[model samples]
Target: MRSVYMDHSATTPVKPEVVEAMLPYFTEIYGNASSVHAFGREARKGVMSARNTIAEYIGASVDELFFTAGGTESDNWAIRGVAHANKQKGNHIITTTIEHHAVLHVCEMLEKEGFEVTYLKTDADGLISLKDLEAAIQPSTILISIMAVNNEIGTIQPIEEIGQIAKKHGVLFHTDAVQALGKIELDVNKQNIDLMSFSAHKLYGPKGIGALYVRKGTRIKNLMDGGAQEKKRRPGTENVPGIIGFGKAVELAAEGFEENNARLIRLRDKMIAGIEATIPYIRLNGHRTKRHPGNVNFCFEFIEGESLLLSLDLVGIAASSGSACTSGSLDPSHVLMAIGLTHEIAHGSLRLSLGEFTTDEDVDYVIEQLKPIVERLRSYSPLYEKATGGTR
Candidate 1:
């Protein structure tokens, strides 16, 4: 069986150049970035260079960017930090119903602490209403947290417009850009994005490394306590090799950003068109165009998503039903529910995300295999029989 990976949203394979850049950091340049020795100085140089590269890529200042374990930690620190620091000022927060668990779960925690949270709804396309966002804001709403892109449906949120609304209402805006970095354009200043979260592994960099962009003068403080590392905002010994890998990945992404997007979009559309033309009773999730370039999602009526995933895997094609973080759950995707999908329809969904390594042949293989898989699965479904009026 020929292997094909179509789950880039879950994670990506580290590129060869990124690995090469990280190796030296693991061996020769092994020193705590906080140490005062010469070895530490060498390590510090590398760490600073990595910081500069990432900071530059997002148009943020080096001082404003802080390293975290990954996207989860970044989201937690941003939401909790801002909410805690501004407690005296307000106890209300505004976020969408379709946020990742990192953001939604934090909001839930804050709610238990007596904070009021407003979860804005999304349309069938998984897009939050900007007017609704503005209207949801109260004088006591201190923060507005939204993800830059929906991880499951690949819906690109209106970050700039949301930022403008947040700014107008004097509410702090934080976006989980873990899915947006390296694939889409991002500028903290231009987008008015006060705080943002990112992960390296989502963009072909090493795992366990991520960054948080905190614009200067944001009314937020440290959530964790310990050493004076990370400007005392996030304190701990840094992961040197991971930092090096993330930096190199960001550098490569910057250089080939446009060309990479063009290729992924082309291949993405090819696969999407193939699935649409060849498959039946399928509903495409998310906006047709205002989405992540490599994202392609569909819900096959009368077919279960997990069964489809398993069948695809048997043929050496890896895919996803929804966010990897919640893959093991028996519950339907909250994102799909927010977009008005019933439990049955959402359970039949499949997400086939492309990436830098995805090729034309790989996509072709999936489409060819998918038709038979769906047909075989639906043949066993009583729902299929009823829907088709016994016309199998």
Candidate 2:
């Protein structure tokens, strides 16, 4: 039985070069980055080098980048930290209804802390209205938190426009770019992004390391209270090995970004075309062209997404319904709901995200396998019969 893994947006497999780069940090250079001794200096060198590589990749200054555990921590720090630090400026934040739970939950927490939050809704194509965003601003609006690319649907938000709006209002702009970093072109300077969140695991680096880009002079309260690591913004013993891996991963991802993205985009479109040609009553999700290179999401009417996932797993095909973090939840994806998908349609949604490792043959195999699976599942669903006028 051949296997194909297509859930790269959730996380990517560690590249061989990244693993090799990190091996030394685990044994030979194992020391706390905060120490002044020779051993500590070695580890610190690795951390600083990694920071430089990441900062340069995103076109940010070295001093503006800070390391974190992963996207969740970075999102929390960006939102809560900015809210707390700017209380004198305002007590309101703006975000979209289709954001990852990381941003949504943190905004909810801030709401409880006496900060007001306005969730802007998305259109059918999963794009937020710039006018709606502009309208959401107020005298109390201090920040706007949005995702660069949606984790579930792969829709690219108009961050540059949003950034312009935020700048016009004198409000800080932060974006969770964990899903967009390696897949798209992002420059903090060109985008006018004040702060951004990143995760290495989503780009073929280690899982336990991430980074946050903070523009110079951006006021942000410390999330942790310990040693003066990460410029006192985030404190703890740094993951030296993970940082090394992340650096190597960033280098490798940048080198092959164009070639890999083109290949993945071809595979993505082939799969979408194949599935649409074979599967009936299927609604394609996300913007057809403005989405990520590897994202192919769809709704198979009447069949449950969990059932499709399990059946695909049986055939050694890995995919997802939404973000891996919320996969276990029985509720339909908030992202799907935000995009105007009904509960029944959202429950039947499936997301297949390609990656560098994905191949032409893998796409063909999945399309062939998925058609029968959907048909078989729909055969058992009475709703399918009713919707199809009992054709099955």
Candidate 3:
């Protein structure tokens, strides 16, 4: 059977062009970006060029962009760095309950270190209420970290509004734009976003490379405490090849962003509609319209997500329940629960995130295979009978 990948949110296949762009850096141009030799200059130039490309994509200054390992590192640095640096000004951080663990765990660590954290609740549609955000703010609030688009449900948050609120409150705003970078327009100035995180692998670029955009004049302590790389904010030898690949990927994504987004939206809608039409007792997750174009999450009542994932894998379909980092855990997604899903319903949720390489045939194959598998699971489910008011 042919394999169909629908888990782009977890990570996407590296684009061929991105791979080609990175090839020379590994062999011919291999050199430490910090060295002063000719090869090092070439490598350093590549890193700077990539930084410029990424900054252009997000409408940030090249000087403000700092390269990191990936989204998790970027997020950790942005949240922890700012919180620690600005502890004199405040010790409170505000964020939503639905954010990726990168931000949440960092906040937890800060909480243990004497900082207060406020986790705002999301509506059933996975949207954070501005009113709740306003209410959560205190005089000691230093930063607000929210994801640009939810990784699990694909719900796009009101980032610009949140930014405005943060600015009005004189608190810094950071967004984990790992899932939003390639799919949406990001203008840091217009949105008033102080810091933003992005990962390359999510946008068809090489893994192990991402960037954090810290707006000019935003004071934040360094996460890694060595070398002057990334202007002393993040220390370590730069990943030259990965940065080049990321630049190429960003260029390609920007070139065909609208076209690819529209195509993915149509495919996502078709997949969602087809599944709902064929599968009984299925509930869609996240906002119906204000969501990422490539994301479709659904909860098929009476079946566990792990069982569904296994069944889909048997039919050569690849998807996920939630974040790839937390896949092994038996606990239901916190994101699902945050959006008002019961634990049972949360356990039944599956996320199918499309990408540029996804096709109509892939969607159809999933729809064709999914219905029978769900039916089989429900047949063996005693809870199905109880929920549906039927005798097994």
- Give a tens-digit lDDT track for model 1, residues 303-374: 899999999999999999999999999899999988999999999999999999999999999999999999
389 Cα displacement, candidate 2 (Å): 2.9
TM-scores for every candidate against the unseen true structure:
0.99, 0.99, 0.98
Order the candidates by TM-score, highest first — what do you get?
A: 1, 2, 3
**Best-to-worst ranking by lDDT:** 1, 2, 3
Candidate 1, pairs of clashing residues:
none
Best model number under lDDT:
1
Q: Model 3 over residues 1-392: C-alpha lDDT tens digits? A: 97999999999999889999999999999999999999999999998899899898888889999888999999998998898899999899999899999999999999999999999998999999999998899999999998999999999998999999999998899999999998988999889999999999999999899989998888798987888887877888889999999999999999999999999999999999999889888889999999999999999888899999999999899999988989999999999998888998899999999989899999999999998999889989988988778853
Error of 2 at 275 (Å): 0.5
lDDT of each: 0.94, 0.93, 0.92
**Prediction 3 TM-score vs. true:** 0.98
Residue-level lDDT of model 2, residues 125-179, one tens digit each, is 8999999999999999889999999998999998899999999989999999999
RMSD of each: 0.7, 0.9, 1.1
What total of clashing residue pairs does each candidate reach? Answer: 0, 0, 0
